[model samples]
Each structure stands twice: as structure tokens, then as C-alpha cells.
Target: MFSIASDSAKSVRYVLEHDHADPNESIGPQSALAFALTNEHLTQKLEIVKALLAHGADPASLRNPELNPPHRDSSVGDDSMLLSPPPTTTLEAMDPATRYFISRADAPQTRHLSTLLQKSLFRPLGGVRYDIVGQDQVFEQLFTVLNLHSRTLSVSPLVILLCGPSGHGKSFLARRFGPLLGVPTHTVNVTTLRSTHDLWDSYSMSPYEEITTRTLAQFLLENEGKRCVVVLDEIEKVEEPKVLYSLLMPWELGERVAGTCSPRAGHRHIDVRQVVWLGTSNIGHDFVFEFCETSSGMSVSHGEYLELARLVRPRVSQSLGASLSSRVTTVLPFVPFTEAELMAIATEAFYSLGGERAYFVSLDIVEHVSRKAIECYIPEEGARSLHRAISSLLMDMPEFLEQSNK
Candidate 1:
């Protein structure tokens, strides 16, 4: 019955009505709701789960006991789940894991569910989950690109160039593509590779070799036939222009020379057709800022920003040379954080500090630091100055504590 319903919610309803199958009844360890939650087909799973929940399925029931117990039914009702209230100070101070459960208690399609589940279930246990704030449009575009790629039978990779100021979360966003898509991410710092020799060796070295690449080649080899995101961080920082040329084949053609010594000797070719190539850059920040400044109150609409990105794409291509830049699918522009967004970041930073220290970190302090950051904000540096402002406040904590005691 469950097998028949795996692809159809109508079948599930029929099974429930005719077979007298309980929606809450455990199939193996998982209830119908839990089973639907585990379904790989997201659209079908969402539909089936919603149907089950409507038919008296308990979301709190769990297939795994070792994991945290099902969330209390405080937020759930006989008919619909209530909307989650805004985060309180207590909720803000809680760890991500706890917050995940609390937020999931009320809503099925909660904003944080995808990110939280990606961290908890998709990633390896105890992996760091980056908080990607204020990049909804980027995520939307990325999903669209991936979906389009998936629908095609082509062997070419999806190439994305992220253009933004330093420390505006471009690299972090690239790394996040892994969890979001349920694949491993391999990050290569382009600045670290000095020559083509470094490139060949880094891409082909084995576990026995001392100068082996971190995880790029190994992950590609192990996860052959699987999708992945390959992030080339700070591509603009690469010293050798020819090295960028060497990567052109891989970026455009999804074909790369696979050998330890050189491109000729033991050379075989490897294909990374299922990979997403993410290149991040701090170029064109000034141009974006200048364009935005000429707009109403220095705030550009998303459409206007995209238009600016289109203009900046040519400038970046001119700088990086036509060969490397012409193959880029799209250049995504990450704008600087607004003052309100910076304040939110500061508050989040304070909450992340945890325990007694987090309690002491007031909104007033966050506002003060965020205001300072707003004043000192530079288009080239982006949110780095804001982060530094927050860090400096934390560094002065001892002095503040001493003063408070007096």
C-alpha cells in the first residue's frame, strides 16, 4: 500500500480509506508522515506529507528514537499547525539544532527547514552550517540553473561567476550549494596555486603523496557519477594568467587532464559534467556602488542590480581576458549589506556567543557597533568592516565587564 502511494497522494488516500490504514501507524520504524519526509522526490513528498498531516498524521512521531524525541504538539492542532511566533531572546540564544526543532514544530515549509535539514541530515555529523543571510535572489537563480541543468542531457557543467566585494559571503554561498543540493563541495583557493605544475599535481596527486590536493580529486574520484559543487575561491587573486587558461577547458568543456606528472605523461581525461563550477570575485564592486548611488537613495531594485551585473560582466571579462570570462554562464552581483541587515547580523553574532556573555550583549551595543560599521563601510570591503566592528566589541568585553562591576 505504501509502495503504491510512494508516487501518488491519491493512492495514499485510497489506501487510507479502503484498507483502513492508519496514517499515524508505523511502517517499519517510520510513520506515513515520516516515510513521506524521507522521500527523495521533493514535490511529491511535500504533497503526500501535507495530505497525511491533514488526515491526522502526527508529525511528532519519529522513525528514529536515537535522535531527539518528536517535538511537543504545542504548535500543532486538530486541523492546521499554527504560525510560529517571531523569535524571542530565549529562542535567539538557543543553538541551531534546538532552534531547528523549535522552528519546525509549527511549519512544514518553514524558511529554515531546508537549511537546517541540509546541515543536520545531508552534511556529515557535527559539520559547520553557515548562516547565509540576505541572498534569496542568488539562491533562486542557483536553483533555477540546477533545475535547468538537470532537465538537459548535456555533459556540460553549470558555471557561475559570483562577483561581489570581499567578505560579502560569495565563497560561503558557493560552499552552501553542496548542502542545498545534497552533494559534497570541494573548495580550491585560486590564490594558493602559483603555477600549472601546482594545478596538475593538485588535481591528480594520490593519498600516498605528501603534496596531495586536499579533497578535490579524491572527492571527484570517489563520488564519480554524483553531483558536486566545485568552488574556485578568489579567482581574481590567481597570480598566473596561464593557470586560469588551463582551467578554461574544465570550466567550459567539463574535461580536464587527469595525471600526476604532467598533461602528457600518464594523462587520462576526467569529466565533471555533473559539477557546478562556482568562481567568486571581488571585482566590479566600485562600479556596482557607483551605479547604485546614482539610483534613488542609493538603493537599487533587484532588476536594476541585475542590469548592473550585465554591464559589469563585460568589465570583468575585459579584466580576466575574453577566453576565461566568455564561457561564464552568469555573473551574480552581491550588494553590500544594509544598516538594518548589519544590525541583525550583529544581534545574531551576539546570540551565537552563548551563555552569560550573550545575555550581557544588548541590542544597544549591537546598534552602536552596526552604526559604526555603517559609517566606515566601504564598497570594496563590504560586510568585513561590520564583522570587524562586532569582533572589536567582543574583544572589549572584559573591559566592559570590569566597568560594569565598578
Candidate 2:
């Protein structure tokens, strides 16, 4: 409510984006939407409305018929929202965007809001994050696959198999994949799933065998028709290779295949198209390192990356089978980090642990910690070992001790 009165678009965006203030929230006598509607004279009012709508402010709620009646909300006295929006200041008197949610007979069938959000939200290739560190070749190939996927028109889910050495940054990149495109990412560790059809588990209820969804299914259904990223981390760890068959429909046809739990075929398919499916595996770890050694260059060229990616195909096929492997749009080789990158990563990780006390710590502190921490890091284990390295360094620091020695 303060945001609407403050008449600042930035504040509205901050409250919506950071505080997650619900736009339709009813407080006392006024709704957030009602307050914003009354303040039509505010300079940034329209932008505030846009921000609210984008963050899930419902337009239909503003079209309440009883709100305009003379005897409306009378018991609320001076605090009533009816006291604010003057009869002359209706939605028609407001901006076009204000009237957009209330579609009258002559209103266009298609709205710009729908088309605006339909397109994928990724920045161009050059704008990809650099914080991921030492996976330039991987990023290049990753964006190349996304460009081809073009979520705007594609019906099938785009699958990109991320296969390379462990701990380098495959999982790290997977976690950030959704945020990079301004969308939600749902990650499932393949090892944790108990059954083959765990992705969309169903159960017979009320003897009717009605289909009810949970977890990943609910996540997909909630995001139906929208672009999202789903990363199956450590997919090769699944006990049964056949577990992947459950995903074949959504991965290749954009539909969720109902399992035996559902006896009915009518509700079988939950439209999960427009998902960019990521599967991370270490199946091609050895080959990625071997290629780096044979090429013997400062950087792996795009062509070389492509060649290495091709090598990953057979690795995936042998491990996960050819049908699923064939559906993969591309297999990106997550290259092992270079020596400099390893230490650089270690140094970054080192400083992050120090808190404010780190400012007092000297250059040798990082060098000292890095050498010991780096010993635990290996190509196969990747950056996963860095945490242990940091723990070892902390053990020697008096400040980090269980009881500090003052």
C-alpha cells in the first residue's frame, strides 16, 4: 500500500520482486490493486501496474461489480477503498493497460502480454555469465544448442547432455541454467529417486485410479506452456537405465507419459513441452581430459569442442542406451579446469570463507590455503574437493576454532 502512495515504480518493483508482496492481497478495506487504481494521477502508475501484473496481480479482481455501488463497503467508514476511487475515475478513464485486463466486446482476442512472455528470456551468447569460470568452450556449445532450440516455436523438449569430468562445474552450471534465462529450474538427483517412474509418480486413489500429481509433476503442470529448465543431475547413477523411458515422452514429444498408476489414458499427457532438459553425467570424463592432452593447446577451439562432443555420443549411448542418446540435441563436454583456473577458483572460494576477518588476512593466507586445498582436488573429483580443502585451512585458523583463543 505504501508503494502505491509513494508513487514510485521502482519501489513497487522492489516490493514485488524482493518482498514478494501479493498484488491481490486484501488488507483492511483496500487491496493493493485497488490502491494502485485509485492513484491514476501518479507518474509511474502504469509502470507500477505492469510490474504488479507481471508478478501475478490478477486483472479480473479489479472488475468487481459490487465495488461501484453507492452503498458498497459502507460499514468500513473512512478507511473504505470505495472512498478513494471516485466514480469519475473508472478503469475506462485510466490508461489502456489498466483496461487491458477487463476485455469488453470490442477488445482484441489476442493480448500483447501473452505474446510478450511467450519468448525465451535468455540474453545473447556474449551476455552469458563469466562467474562459471573456465568452461568457455562448454558455454559456447551450450548457447549454440539453446539458439537452435528456440523455445518460441518448438513443441518437443530440448535435451542437452552435459557429460564431462566431475567437480569442474557441470552441476554448478546446471543450477544456474534457469536463472540465466530468467526462468525456474527444477533439479532432481537421479540417485535419490527410488522408482523408475519417480519423475511423475502416480497412485490409485478411491478405487477409481484417478490421476493425482506430486513434486516434479506438479512443478511441470504449474509451469505448463511456459519455458523452464529441468536438470537431472548424475543421471548415470540411476539403478535402472530403463528409468529414462519415463522421460522419453516429455523429452521427445513434450508430453508426460502416465505410468501404470493411472488406468485412464484421457489425463495421461500433462503438456510439459518447452522444457530444456539437462542431464549431467561423468560418462565422458576420461575422454574430455584425454582430448585436452592430445590437442595440447592453450584453448580448445569450437571445432575441437565439436569433435569432443561427438566423442561423448558413444559414451552416452553405451552407458544410457542409443534411443535416449539419439534424442539428445548435443552432448557438451565440460572440460577439466586448467591449473590457473583451479587456483583461481580456490582463491575465490578461500576469500568467501573469511568473512570480514578475511580483509585482515594477507596474500600468503590464500596461497597457503590454496596449496593444501588444491591437493584434494583432482580431475575426476573436479571442484567438489574444494570444500574439504577449505575445511582443512579453517582447522588451522585460531579464529575459526570451536573456542577462539583470545
Candidate 3:
């Protein structure tokens, strides 16, 4: 009976006490202790958990007996200890498992929220550590922004603009840390977005006019009151002034409408203003050349970028809505990927598949293949070319063939 009840009972206790606990774990009638542990209130649930732990519950036991709370044959009147000292004192004498269970029950809500965030979001973000290195000031600024936004119980959104060249790991950093901070991410491919209409027509309409319409806004609404990190990738692709203006409007004020088109007939608008938006761009070799032609540095000059952004604000307002382009602040640069960084990313990928041997094979073959791909293709290319090059390298590898044969 003890064996049968233990598995379900432990699972029930876990779900009620642990922040990451899945409420769906299986339980049965024979596991009366498990069934009792499902009480919603923390106080009631913890009492049951305490009772089980105090009664010498073995945490390792999994199998449940057909009968639990096994009926005792002897009389209980001889045992007077139960009516004496309280279980509170008895609780102090138990193992860590018991202590941990009790302590978790008493833990504050913030700790529970942290645990839940870690389990659901951070765990899946590849556990990548932030590389502060030369960017201590930058990291401090980012952290300050994140903390400010997190402390907001209402709608105080903080926009973190990561401006650097391509391949600098901007997206990687955002993806990795966004979830852990309880901030949801929705990336916008700036290159793909040519016109105000382009953003609207591409994605489907469900919670909004179109799927892409205010993508960040929709994600924020879904996870209301939570910090949100919106990544606008490759914004340099949006050379048009109108598009740039539209993108910035949302960050300035409280709300910015992306469109006005609904299923009923007319246009539908996507209102998303209270979100932290990060825009990234890589303008090739002509960074200073193009921007200087107008008024700023191709990538680094904030003043020039802002001026250019302001010039195109009207197009977005006219097409989307005057209300849409009213909110935008800050234009950050995307750093280019250095040879060493690219190599590091490749090495990381190899180790992720396995380790040691796998890493060696992938690095050796992938580097050779990637170099050859660039040599065979045009001087300037994009992600598609890179993907093809990698695919070609994997296909040509002798080790890959051997593995497939096995």
C-alpha cells in the first residue's frame, strides 16, 4: 500500500509546492494522500505534505500499492505521543526533502515567479551566459532597463535598442535572455518590410488585423503586464523613410497602430505601444557614405539616424494612421559578425549536437565548405547562401555519409 501510494502522492505534493510543477501529473483513488494534496490553497496543501513527510514518506518510492493508507491490525490507544508535542517541532528533525517541501510552501510569491520563469522560459533559451567583456557599460545599461521594466507592475515598458553590425549576436542575446526576464519576444525582419502595406499583408489575422500587424503588441497583450523584448532585425533593409518612421512611432508614446483591416471588411488596426522595441541593422560597406549623403553616420551617428527617422514619419501616419507613428524613440546599430565570432558560433553549434568527436568533424568540414561556398558565389550574399553552403558541406562530408550508413 505504501509503495502504490508513494508515486502519486509525491507527484501531487510536487505540483502544489514546486513553482515549475505540472498540475497534470497522474493520480489515482488508491493514492489517497496524493488525492488530498491537490487542495488549491497553499496552507491546506502544505499541511497534507507536512503530514506525509512527518510519517516517514520515502521520496524515492514510485510504484503505488493497490491499497494505500494501509489498515493497521493493532490498537492505537497505547501510542500517546501523537497527542503530545506538535508536528512543528517534529518537522525540524526531518531530512532536506521534508525541509525543502515545507520551506517552499512558505516561500514568497516573487521566488515562485522566478522559478516559474526559469522553468518555462529561461531553460529553453540555451542557458547561454551573457558575454559582458568590453561592454560592461552597455550591459549595465541593458540590465538597468530590464530591471526598471520588470519592477513595473502596471504598463511601464522599456525599449532596449541593440545596435550593432550583422552577426554580432544581437538576436542571440535577445532570444536567450528575453524569456528568463519574463519578457516575450517577436522579431521583425526589417529587410522583408518594404512598405507599410507589406507588414500587413504577409501575416495572418487572428488577435489582430494581420499576424505581423503589431507582432510585439500582440505578444505583450497575450502575456499582459510582463516585460516584452521586440527585436526588429535588419532594419537597414527598410531604406524607405515611411517604413522607418512607422517602426519608431510605437516606442515614443503609449500605443501605435500598425494597420486598419479586419475580416468584416474595412481595415484593421494593431495597437502596440507599451513594448520594449530593439531595432538592428547592417548597411554593408557604405555605412558612412549613404548616411553622410543625407545627414548622418551610416551606423553609429544617433543624431543623423534620428533626423532621417523623423523625416519619414508622415508616410507611416498617412498609410497606417497618424496615431500609429506618434510613438518611437531610439535607433540602435547592429554590429557585423567578425571571423572569430562566426567561427565560435560554428563551434558552438557542433558541440550542441554532441561533443568532442562531433565538434571536430563539424568544424573541419563546415569551415572548408563555408569558405568554398563564398569562393564559388558572388562577393556579397545573404542568409540563404549561408544555409546552402552549410547544407552542401554536410552532404559532402564522409563522416556524415558513414553515420547515415549506420
Candidate 4:
């Protein structure tokens, strides 16, 4: 295959034969242009470099401090010509999202590459949907919740209930939609907060107040005037349900809950309606399904689904303050993506890599891995497994090139 070639002419002929555009034609984020620059193999590197330039990499895009082409000393070979000059173009001119796909080709340190990539690919706190397919309705609903809390709009108290079975993508939806709605999304992992003091110290605030007040204070200081999307992941795990009441009160009441902190010494209020609160849980649906089947001696015509908000209400009321509990809304269950959707997500991952040389193991690959993960009741990790599989596959390509040299 072209990807395993040792020489430039053969790779070029492979591209011409296949009528490919860039090495990225095979992968979504990985590109031949970026790959060529990263590979240590001098001759293959030159070929891919020429191929990238011939295809579309702006000659001017390669430059120092900008796209610090690997140092000559770090190159795979002693070929001084390859390291003597830097590539000459800004990442902006290349396929911006996938440009850094090859940034680690000759990585001695991946920190620079990771930092550059985090800036380039997606914003911090911004969400990425790895393999989600066909959730236009979900996206629309999220946007609706976000638009309601827009600073530009004067909206009423609003609470969004995002519930779903594990691996159904509720968390992914909230994270991705937060930025679009112009609200910063914050995820609360109650398990990470061992004690009330742990919670207070975690946010660098006083334990005299509930965790929500402190969290809101910090969020407001940094992102004032912006609506915030709060994701309460795995609400079932909270040791104290009262905590939920404190967290949801402001959003429910459309006012901020004042804390005993140095600032806001007295009770103060914030517009709660401006912040969208999303809670996800997997607790109730199974109970509901079993109840329906046994009690009625027949299942409902429609399928049963659990809502986290309903399941955790008693706890939320107990942990959170009474005032906060009144402002909450029940969560809705999220629909799972179909098989076709999973395939589409895989396709997108490949497309994002730059497609040309990117190789997807196949639907069988996803099924083999996902089914195994599902059997373990950890479908969420399936995407990660797929990533590892692809990483393993691509890792073999460079090694193949190395063997060809022998």
C-alpha cells in the first residue's frame, strides 16, 4: 500500500493511482503532509513532504516558532538536508483542525504538541462528539435550553433534565452544547468530593456554605454575564442528596444563592434562569420497566425509560436546601444512537483525520470491541477502545516503513 512505501516515486504513483488528494484523505485528523513532516525516515519523509506540497500544503506554511518542523538532529536519519530548513506555512493555511495531526511525528516531547493541539482542535471546556450520529433533535433541544439562558435575552427560571442510560451520550450532549448556547458548562463529580470540607477546599471556598454557592461564585467571577450549563454527572452517587438542592436553587429560582464568603457577606442573589442545569442518571428506568411488566401483567406499548431527576429527587431535596429544591425540574431520558449512527461516528473520526491514509478497522471492528465492552457493561469506553485499536494499527505503518529499509 502507498502508506507503507519506502520511496517518494512509489508513494506518488500510489496517490496518482488512487487519485487521492492528501494523506489526510485516509484519516480525519492525520494528514500525509503532517505525517511526512513528522516521520524520521528521511527519504519517505521527503516524498510525503513533496506529495503534501504538491497536493496543497502551502510552501509558506512551514516556518520556525510557527510550525517548528522537527530539528535536524531529531530526524530519523543523518540526512542534514531534511533538517536544514523548516516547513513554511502557518497552521491557519492548512486544514486547520487536522493540521496538528502530525505534530508529534518526531516527538521528543509531546507537551508542546498537546498544547498546540488543544488550542487548535477544540477550545478548553469545549466538547467534542467523537462518534455520535444523528442527534439533531438532541442538539436542537440543547440549543433551546441554551438560548433560553442567553444574556441577550431576559428569560425565566429554567432547568434542563438530561437523562439517559449509561453510554447513551447524555454527558456528551451537555458538554458539546454548552459552548453553543454561550453558557460555560461545569461538571460536578460528587465522588471526587469526599466531605463537605473537601468540597469547600476543592473550590477554595469556606465550608460554612454549600458547594453550589462557592462554585457559582467562582464561575461568575471568571465568566460573568455568560449563561452556564451545569452537568451533574451520575447523580446517583452523591452521598448526600441535600447537595443537589443547594446546587439547583439558583438556577431554579432565577437568582443566586449568597454565601458566607468574604465577598457577598450577606445573602445575595443571581439570576438562576440564566444558567442551564442538566442532570443525568441511570437509576429509575429499570425499576419502571420491571414494575410495568409485573404489575400490569403486560408491558406498556411504549418502552420504559428512567429519568435521573425523578430518581434522585428525594436525595436532591435532602442534600440541597429546601429553597433550592423548589426551583428544580425533572430530567428526560435520552435516546440511544442506532448502529448506523455508530458507523457514522467512526466515519467522521476518519474524515477528521484527513482520510487519505487513515484506515478504519471496519464496522466489525467497532462491533467486536463495542460488544465486548458492552458485555462488561462499560460501553462508554468503547470509543476509547476503538481509538486504541486505530492507534495500534497506525503505529504499525511507520514500523513497516522501517522494515522496508532492511
Candidate 5:
């Protein structure tokens, strides 16, 4: 019956009625819903799932029997099914199968199916509001690494250094990391400071110091007993290398003490043990671009690009200093956007500016702007120029709107 694809709904109903099959039956530790949700063939067949659900399928069924409570066999004539117990471990600690199911549930197309399931089934997995586009692999790695440390209660700070061309959303990626881990984020532009004291204190009580102190204190207090992501943007631009030492305490030991050179210098301490540090730079942007642009006209494969990144690590490390570079858990490279991604960005920008009228803008116009943007693309400048090109194209929206109304 399962072999028939087009008549899945009718087949499912027939099997359930005649074979007396339990809609929530386990097939190799996976419930029908779990198999249906994860199976690429079945996931898109919403009618099949609807048919199973109509036949009393329990959406709350889990793949791991260990995570579920002992239940009476419904096939033995008693139709009452016991409710599954809540997971004993955090979502990060759960087995891979469960995590995969959760990821599938989080998909936009499956949101309706998720809604039908009991909230308690998935509520243990904390919600993360991350809307950053592209770089799926980067986010996956970030979650795995951070979640591993979180589960182990490791003292070593989770530090990620993002190396990319300017305007490739390095800082934006850092900001998105906080919400994924259910934490707040604080960003500091490392280039603006002149000395180590500028990070935490100043001897003369300068305005910069006052503002920095207030922001630090507020963040520390508000996020007490919880993790926070601290983003140091453009670390390569810092004038004084000594100032970089301020990060070592929090990054390695998870605490920062006020230095003797400060205004509030009575041994003020900040408990930053739960802090995750994100540092961004454009130090080796040109090298990455040059390596990717081949004489044969074909773009570099992902594996080749990564290999090149490894080869250039020494250069980046030298520029940022060994001490800072050594502390970083991983240096993530954000590649330049492809033509398709640029077009998507341009379309998004048009929608942002034009609202409902965005649809009226012809595809030819969007493609033209996208092509011009790509032609003007400079690896060092990144997405900033593309965004500007889209903005410039939208400047004629009034005329387009008038013509559309006619």
C-alpha cells in the first residue's frame, strides 16, 4: 500500500481500517509522524499526513523510545493513548534524530503541522529569532560548537572570529548569534578607542569612558546569570595592541576586573563567564577574493576555498597578533555574494522601499540593476555597493507607480 505514491491518502485510510494498523505505530524507533515528517518523499505529501492524522495519528510521538513514557498498546483494543513525557535533557543534549525532526518542524512549510502538535512537545527547545539570510552551514557550525560548550559547562569562552569583506554582514552575523543562544548582545567598535583604558575606564573621566562604563554596567547587570554575545567590530583597526588584552580575561577565564588606571578603581569585577565573544575583521579580504576568482572563469569550489583559507591563516594571525588569534575557537570566512544572492538582496530592498508596489517593478529592471551592481562589484567593498545600486534603481519608483496606475 505504501508503494503507491499518487493514492497515498486512500491507501493510508485503507491500511488503517483493514490491517487495523496504529497510525502512531513505531517503525524502527520512528513513529509514523516522525518518519512522515523527515521523509523527503512524504513531507511534501500533506494529504498523506492529513489522512494519518484523521486516523488518530499522534503528532507528539518521538523517535527515541527512551525519551517517551511507557504507553499501553492501542492495537490491543484499548484506544486510549498515554501522553508522552517531557524531555529530560535540553534540546542540545538530545540525540541527532530528535534535533533533525525539530529542524524539519521549524521549516515555514511545516509550521502548520507543528501548530497541530502539542506545544509542550517542542517548547523545551528554546526559540531563536534569527533572520540572517544565506550561510546555513555557518549557523549550523555555530550552534553545534556553542551548544557543545554549553552542555559541558566549559570555562573556555566561546570565541568566533569572522573574517570577510566589508559589508558582507560580519557584524550582522555576530548580532544574530545572541538570539539563537537565547542571550542579549553588546557591540563595541574597536577602532574608535585610543587606549586600553577606553574599554573599561579612563583616568580623567572622559565622556567616552563615561558612556562605555554605563553601557558595560547595564549589560552586565541585565544579563547576570545568563550568557551574552559581545561583538568587537574591526579589531584589526585598533591603534593600541595593549587594549586587546581586555578580551583575554573574559575569553579565557570568563571574568573581567577593573584595572588600576580607572575612575571606579576599587576592584570592580564583572562576571562574564557566560559571555560569547565575536570579533570581525576585513584583514585578508583581498586575498580571499583573488583566490576565488580563477583564470578559467569557474568559481572556486567550497572545499578549495576552505583549503585556501587554511593556507592564509598565518597571514591573518600575524596581522591580528598571535595572542588574539590563538584564543579564537574558529575563524569563519564569509565569501562574497553570488549573482543570485545579489539579486535577492536587491529584490528585498525594493520590497522594503516600495511595499506592495514592489511587485509592479519589472523583472528586467531588477535584473538590470543586479547586473550593474555585479559589474561594479569590488571584493573589498562587498554588498554595500549592491545595496546602493538597488537604492538608486528605486529612486524612479514614483514614475513607475504613475505608469502602473495608468
Candidate 6:
């Protein structure tokens, strides 16, 4: 990383070419491309970026968005240089995946959004380490989806169904989707809606509660014509499958229907030309557990996932009905966490206690917390029990207690 940040371009090229260093690596919070641009000379900075890109560096930059937001007239010359299209020779050297995001056959007028998507999605890239673990297949699918969405102006809203057991990062992915694709994302709990009318008009859960405009229709109105993601979470929990009829128009036509059902909505049709219609459910999680009982909550093979997905579809079809189920473009099955993956999650949770990122927790404490969390894990319920296990163990620890008392 320092070699790229150094003034000598030869040092950067030599490491990537001869040493075969990973171009996508991050030294702490910054990606190699980000660190490279910090060099003193414009000539040297360009050289380092080209070297990194040639070596298959992700153009979806891991640079913090706050520092690099589409600066047009900056005093620094590197902004324009960094935004410039890579030389053809450099693009030729890049891997197909890296090349597709930045270099399109027909670069659209909205091509700049691709750069935004790159910088925003999977933020603080931390090399390849992500907050959400054990879901590489999910990430790869989204990477391509977001890239396509970024380049287009009026693609239909995509419906993706995430099917699996709970606490397996399904909700985490829903929340991450907002920043991951650089679009406004809204999540509606299908279980909470009283009727299709509740989508446009807010209703009280109880008599004491007042009405609010925080409905799905309002979310659509706010981000109308702009690319957005609306997560219909807990889709299987809705009482009547007919409630999902509200989704058909938006999912298929990129046009969210709003009638004069309520005074707030007042018969307005919202055009959601570019939107992601995401749904999460645990329809066929039982089959997953049955298949992976011997693996002890480890990994699932590609063939196994395919088999699981087939089993999942019929269950989703049963719950959502035929028409709604067919709208789902792809069903992604989130596999149960492996022992190592669970341990990593626990360690991260321990360190993140009291909103700190630094690893203040001791190695012994980390191991203990992680083991207790994993031990208490419920396969059926997923890793939701992990936090409770961790919290119970943490109360007696002095470091945790010190931070809590503060």
C-alpha cells in the first residue's frame, strides 16, 4: 500500500506485476486506489491508479463518500484525473468484473452514477472484509445488478426474494442495500399492514396511536422516478396473500399505483422506473437445516443451495400466491453461519459495543464471548440468540463495565 502511495511509480508497478499483490486490498480504512491518489505528483498518482486498475482493482472505490462526492471545480487536479476514463491499454489489462463497472461499451450520460455506486456500495470496503459475512454469492449478484441499474435510466424495478432462516443477515442486507446501490431504500413490514389501503394511508396500531404518513406510498412519492429499493420484509407473515397485489404494478411496470384511497395520497401514480423490490421470508428454512444437519451450521454447496432454492419456491408460492410469487426474479437462499463465521460476528459485536470500532476486548474475552454466543445459537431461530448470550457474559467483564458506566 505504501509503495502505491510513494512517489516512485516503478515501486507500485513492480509490486503489482512481480510481487502479484492484491490490487483490491485496503491498508486499514482506505483502498489501494484511494491511498494512491494521495500521492504528491499528479503524474505519479495517475501511474499508481492505472497500475491498480490494470491489476483488477474494483472501480467501485472504497474511498469514504463524504470526502469524494462528485467534486467538479476542486482546486486539486487529481479529482478530474481520477474520474477520467482509464486508458484502453489499462482496461485491457483489467479483469472482466472490474472492467465492466467502469468501462461500458456504450457509456451513458448517467455513467457518473456508476462511480457513485462504486464509492457508496460496500462502503469502507476494508479490502474484501464486509460487515455481512458468508454471503459472497449474494454480493456478486448485487454487484452486477447495481452496475446495470447505475448505467440505465428507466429499467423496471427488480423483485428479489431472500429466503432462509432468521438472523442470517437477511435484514442486514436489506438495510445495506440503500447505501450499497447509492439509492433511497425503504423497508415495510408486510406483517404490520392491515390492508392494501394501509400502503397509501397510515393507520393506528392501537386507538391511542396517531396517524402518520410513513407509508409505502409516501416512500415512493419521495423518491419518485429515482432509483430506490423497497424491502417488503416478512412477506410470509402477512395474513392475506392478496395484500401483495399492491406490489404487482411496481414490480412489473416500474409504476407504483396510488388511488384516492386516502387524502394524503389523493390518486397519484408514482413512477418508480428504477427500483428494487426486495422481499425477505423464511418459507423453506426447515429444508436448509435438514440438509445441513451434518455440517453443523457450516457452508452449503452451490448444488445444495440450488436444491434448497427449488424447495423454497413452492413454499413462497403457497404463501404469496402464484401471481405474486412469479414476480420474484430470483430467490437467494442465505445459508446458516459456519462456526468460524459465527465467531467472527461475535468478535465484531463485542468490539462494536458502546459504538467503538477498536478491538479493546481481550483475546480471552473475545474467545469466551464468541464461544458462548455460538453455543447458545438456535439453528431454527438463527443467530438472534448470540447477542443475548454475549450480553450476559459481558456484564461481568471490567472492560465492558467500564465503557457502560461511562
lDDT: which candidate is best? 2
Error of 3 at 301 (Å): 19
Report the error of model 5 at residue 313, Å. 3.2
**RMSD versus native structure for model 5:** 15.0
Candidate 5, 213-291: lDDT as tens digits: 3454466556755777677878788888778876666666666664432234577666677777788888778776776
| Candidate 1 ranges beyond 4 A from true positions | 1-130, 203-219, 260-266, 297-299, 353-356, 360-379, 394-406
Cα lDDT listed for each candidate: 0.57, 0.63, 0.40, 0.43, 0.56, 0.59
Candidate 6 Cα misplacement greater than 4 A, ranges: 1-129, 144-154, 202-214, 260-269, 294-297, 354-358, 396-406
Q: List the residue pairs that clash in candidate 2.
A: 167-383
TM-score of each: 0.62, 0.61, 0.40, 0.45, 0.60, 0.61
List model 3 lDDT by residue over 289-360, tens digit each.
344345422232434544543443443334334543344333233323323333333323332232233322
lDDT of 4 at 221: 46
Across 178-233, the per-residue lDDT of candidate 6 in tens digits comes to: 65445766667678877777655642122222345466677677778776777777
Error of 3 at 182 (Å): 4.0
RMSD of each: 12.0, 17.3, 16.9, 15.3, 15.0, 14.0
Q: Across residues 1-406, which tens digit of lDDT does each residue of candidate 2 receive?
A: 7787887878986886676678678544555665676654565554566566545555555555333222244556767635434432365444322343323211232122233233434442222233355676776566555554665455667888888887777777776677646676677778776676675542211121124434567668778878887888888888877777777656677777444323346666677777878888988788888888888563677688888888778989999888878888788888877665676667556645644354234445546676778888866787768766776678676454222222
Estimate the TM-score for candidate 1. Answer: 0.62
Question: How many angstroms is residue 213 displaced in model 6 relative to the true structure, after the best TM-score fit?
Answer: 3.5
lDDT per residue as tens, model 1, 88-112: 2123533332233333333443333
Question: How should the candidates be ordered by lDDT, best one leading?
Answer: 2, 6, 1, 5, 4, 3
